[model samples]
Target: MASSRLYLSAKSAAALDAELMSSGGFSLDQLMELAGLSCAQAVYKSHPPESKRNVLIIAGPGNNGGDGLVAARHLKLFGYDPVVYYPKRPNKDIYNRLFTQLSNLKVSFTDDVNKAITETDQILDAIFGFSFQPPIRDPFVQVIRLLESTEKPVISVDIPSSWNVDSGPPKSGELGAAFMPDVLVSLTAPKPAAKFFKGRHFLGGRFVSKEIAKKWGFSLPDYPGVDQIVELPADNEKL
Candidate 1:
């Protein structure tokens, strides 16, 4: 059943990436782009752009942030007004290029989470990847705190900030004091948190080739036509 679908740990997910890319003939950029585009699709599918056109993208300093940057680009093109909150940016050129792309597209960046939340109808939480640890520090702590305090809907990318990959929520009061996503998008594979997500869930990483799926023993549901993403079955549904 979908409730009993497989989940990957941080270690296992990393290994799958190495195997998928090294042996399965895919590049990191390809996966990132696919994941980001899938996220944009989820944003539109979950909430109609006509009613919810304003989005606040909260990005971290890792690859997940890169995904947000890419997603913001597509969200803008998709007819949604996406503003970004990139507290800490990675020094990688690819990330800079993405930032540049946003600039070229005239997408604005905001540092104030509270203000951005007021302006946006929804949020994309890309502030952490699978490797994030609990007790989030500094600006991220402040940003996440604001997100939790507000009622704006959030769509967490990959893993929610400070959540443990294998153990679901980290060991803290009420799910690690993290921002609970209204919609959760799992890239590459669903982490253990998939079981905890009661909201709409999406499985991304369509870039995974057939060889990788067979070798890694992953059974993915049909994405349907040209859609970049598809809603995952609820726990009650059979896999």
Candidate 2:
């Protein structure tokens, strides 16, 4: 049976990225842009019409943050105030470009993580991605606390921080204390992490995608699956 329910493992997700980069002819940067754009589309849908909803992105020093920075730029284009919380500067060359783009776009930035958490209605957890190792602590842990306490809806990019994408178990002790995401914006594919971890425990979150579904011949009916993912074919043709 082609199950109405579909689930993806982390390894499958990696393979999807490799295929998209090599066969589909998209660069990593392009993929990141699509990932962010997909995420922004979801956030826009969930937001109420009247309030000028704030999107606070918790960015760390890696590709995850790069994704968040990309999302922030797109969010701004859609007229939302996206405040980025950079706990640390990203070291990767790819992120340097992301930094430059954010700078040129004039998106706001703050080192005060606490303040950023307090001021926003929506939080994007780009602090950690799927490649993370255990023992989540310090600034990441602190950010988790803020995410939990903010009591606002959180939309995690790729995977939630302090979560093992493979094991599908949340971190123990202080790390486990954080709140679960209201939505997880898995890039280029759905993930076992997003599906099982929340499902097994009855923790609530929805797996959202725009890029991966298009590449894989799947579709998201309830979200902006069409405008973002389906439109990419025309974009690719312009290249």
- Predicted model with the maximum lDDT: 1
Among residues 3 or more apart in sequence or in different chains, the pairs in candidate 1 whose N, CA or C atoms overlap within 3 Å are none
After superposition, candidate 1 runs with Cα above 4 Å error: 1-5, 172-175
Model 2, TM vs. native: 0.78
Scored by TM-score, the top model is 1
Q: Write the per-residue lDDT of candidate 2 for residues 79-127, one digit (tens) a residue.
A: 8888998868857788878888888999899888887777887887788
Q: Which residues of candidate 2, in runs, are more than 4 Å off?
A: 1-5, 171-174, 196-225, 229-239
lDDT of 1 at 19: 78
Give candidate 2's root-mean-square deviation (CA, Å): 7.3
- Local distance difference test, per candidate? 0.81, 0.67
TM-score of each: 0.93, 0.78
lDDT of 1 by residue, 1-239 (tens): 34334677788788887876777677877777888998898899898689899999999998889899899999999999999999888788889999999999999998777788888999998888887866678887677677667788889898877677776765556534555778989897788776766788888867776766656656667787888787887862433
